[model samples]
Target: MPELNVMSEPSVRPPMTTGTGKPLSVTALRKTYGGVTAVDEVSMEIAAGEFVTFLGSSGSGKTTTLMMIAGFCEPDSGSIVVGGRDVTRLAPQKRGLGFVFQQYLLFPHMSVWENVAFPLQLRGVPKAELRRRVGETLEMAGLSAMSRRRPRELSGGQQQRVALCRALVYRPPVILMDEPLGALDKKLRDQLQTEIKRIQRELGLTVIYVTHDQEEALVLSDRIAVMRDGRIDQFDTPQELFERPRTPFVADFLGAANFLPGRVEEQTADHTLVRLDSGGLLKARPQPAPPPPPQAASRSASQAARVRAAVQPGRLALCPPEHGFCTGTVEAVTYVGTLVRATVRPLGGAPGDLVRLELPAGHAPALGERVGVTAAPANVSVFPDVVPDTESGG
Candidate 1:
């Protein structure tokens, strides 16, 4: 895919800070249903004007946490703070948050202008002011020419744009989007993702967007909270999350990875040496270990053992068997435009265990050919082997 150009020229509109687009803080948020915990102690801070996404598979507690922030779902425990004011118990309408869902919940009978103007009307803005704001918002969304059209008369993309315009027209402090582009086609989704980022930056809006689409999260979010089994496994900038994933679940979910069981042989502040189960010594860079919790600092020696290592497919390259880290036989190879993905079964791995490698289309190995796989130490990520939930993936 071509690199995304999200840093376009800023809009010329004057900064309008309705509700001041203030910072949002979700603290120890908890929710449960029928003896099952849907969200557990979820906590995050979204800076004013920052775009943060809750990304995870279905039932991972991302959506539940978002609902709690929007005041649509009351939490069993925890606080929801917007601009330093606690709104944990506020009604959805009283929380002053704009929300857009996957379904374009436009009024079928109302014209585009009417739909965009609904929130201002509810707030009792003067009729003249409502018309002016609605007109400006419609034009901003490039729907000015279709202002008189009804929902049924517009294309799916246009309808979704109308939904976005409606959410932005009132300029609430923070906007919460739940899979807003989930129903759109790829072309439209890409277009809207660009527009959403542009609009958010132009208006300095603090947005909490939720989506199961990893690419979308990477493209749009200033930071992402990767959730699993009702908890955030890791929250960090896109580059950090992908390059230095703190856990196996995050490493696997963010991209394709090959997990090789290994035991640490030597460690230092910056690097680690591991002996793979296949009997190859591999070097890998290590992230600084987080300070152990006060309660766990005094644990027994066995409880402080080192973990396994993982590497991305893109990081591994094919080389002559004697010169590479591990020797493998290519089981299959498929051309995918710019790259050829080869599935290989290593010499000492169990049957059915395979590693995938993305090679340049011109140099990919033929099926059944013996090859060696190697990666730079910096490209490998080592973490404790915490089995991920069965439901977590791209």
Candidate 2:
């Protein structure tokens, strides 16, 4: 095995501000309400002109963190730095953040232009300047033509576009969005999703977005922070988060995963033999080098770090089919749009360990057919353990 350096920091973009002026940073961030901990010690830095997202399920602390950054909630312990200065206790308005919500939150009596102008008006900008600013924001939000319409007069998507314009009218440096598309239907939500990306990119705005939808995060963010129980469990670019998840929870949360529990049975120069508790032997490629002696630790640390990085080795499952090992009668099959899933009971598989294979729909083997299951090395993802490795063994 190659020497593994466990302390290397991953590459990340530096925090910066948007076109407006707001900047954001959180250090040792924590939020508590009575006895309940709503957010743990979360630290983040958002650079200017970057789009970052808080992605997780409800109660995962994504929204709470967003609220803290927006100055809507006070952190029990932590520092929020914006524009290179600490503003942990500043008022929301003083922090210069524009916030949007799932609901349109527009005034029923106001037209789109009036709604967009409201922020400028509150800031005491003159009518002439406010009108110009509102017009610019309306155009940015693709709502210039609907500027005269009331919120009720627009479709859900149009109302949302107006809300976005209102949020941007004052041109705050950072925009905090809390599931802003949640209230829209699927088609409208998808449409607005693209629009949000385009607008954020074109204007070079710093955006901190919150969403429970994984696909949304994948599509919208340059990077994602996955939260669990008020703490950030992982933060990385979406591709790294998906293809090389550092934890089982992240892997499972992102998509369907087949977890095969196992133990290292033996190790050789080239491979580690892992014995699956489910009764199969898996061949895993070894790290390129082994740890160096203590006296040379520092000299070899960097080299070891590169070798210890996660490897994208292919995984295999024993089953009856082309390249599969275990043979069994098909128990059930379900046809989805492009693929068919087959549930089969292998000779040694536990009740819950029944294997599922996704094949092209029309080519599915019939139910009750005796067949073999095969896995291509590249089709499988091998984690050192069913759980994340705390120390290097792979």
Candidate 3:
């Protein structure tokens, strides 16, 4: 990549929470390929300079949505506005955007300096400016010492850094990263995660990063857009997404959740009592009046949460075998890192009654020991049963 010998001093500012200009907004974006709708009416707002991640499993249309925003895949309908300007029809190059793909996409025969300089050269920048820009970019990527190195000479992390420097050499306001760290090992991925965050912050670049890893999304994003079946399931900050998912799909996708089927039994001033079909009554913080009927109901858990009032009206339906819940004896235990996982049978009649609990391994519980498990009422969620067809929405 071409080295960026930056003549201009770019200020490293605080990570952006809001757009310095108007927010980047996508309105009713839709794309269809033959019989499959790749991206279906996806709409979201990305604050300028904020790192927003599109996270989903394969074939979930996250890549399609990113491509549409980059103008590589034209949307059949809807609009993309950046900093208040509608750029739905703009060419990818003309949009002043930088993109880094999973494969690095560097010319193997080209020197690192040349690779970094390619963007500037494409823009018809002066030779002096190109050299300066590429040199500075190389330094920013921590590769000034290896400007002549080929892709094969560098580590996977370093190669991706070169790709990133290539994307940033022009100092574009927006950057798109498509699984740039996907191929790296766990340690390198962790290292580059910090680097990517630092570079994005230092350059004040608005980023649309895509990945299927929930941990990556949580660690890196100011907000996450969870896509499913060509549509956005939910969009929220990591904390909000984890704590109060608007949909069952969002809750389940972000982490392990316990779901129970229930119906609104009564609404009081401070709580809504719902009767579970699984033989339990659940209390939930009262939702707004005229709340939408519970659809695809589910609840997320940090660990095995206890329901103090759960057994009042009905039996506990499902509990994670990792968190201690259920009335049966401990069947087995597995120690993993700082936590120990125990499986128990709440109902002795079936083998599947195993409830898992996550507890400190320092003072591990004994096997075959009968233990009582309880989770707070607030931790449990009461909702309608899930549909058979839509089992995995997250």
lDDT of 3 by residue, 1-394 (tens): 4444433323332222323223589999999999888888888878878899999888889999999888898999999998778889999877887899999999998878778888888798987667666766677678988887789998889899999998888877678899888999998999999999887777667899999998899999999998889888889899887766666667667764545444666678777665443333556655532333343134443111222111211122223434433355677878888767666555433444335566666745578766655555445544334422234433
In angstroms, the error of model 2 at 256 is 2.7
Best candidate, TM-score: 1
Model 3: C-alpha RMSD to truth? 6.9
Worst 10 residues of 1 by lDDT: 1-10
Residue clash pairs of candidate 1: none
Q: Report, for all candidates in order, the number of backbone clashes.
A: 0, 22, 40
lDDT against true structure, model 1:
0.83
Report the candidate with higher lDDT, 1 versus 3: 1
Better of 1 and 2 by lDDT: 1
Worst 10 contiguous positions by lDDT, candidate 3? 306-315
Better of 2 and 3 by lDDT: 3
TM-score per candidate, chains pooled: 0.89, 0.78, 0.80
Task: Tell me which of candidates 2 and 3 scores higher on TM-score.
Answer: 3
Arrange candidates by TM-score, highest first: which order? Answer: 1, 3, 2
Write one digit per residue (lDDT tens) for candidate 2, span 1-394.
2211211222332222236534578899998888988888999888887789998877888898888888888889999887787878988989888899989899988777777777777788876566566666666676777767778999988988888888877777888999999887888888999999988887788899999888889999988998888878789999878775656567667654556555555566766555555465555455223333344455554432221112221122324454344566689888887877777776566667666666776777778887775554323344543333222110
Q: Model 1 segments beyond 4 Å from truth?
A: 1-20, 287-307, 392-394
User: Which tens-of-lDDT digit does each residue in 217-258 have in candidate 1?
Assistant: 999999999999899999999999988888778888988578
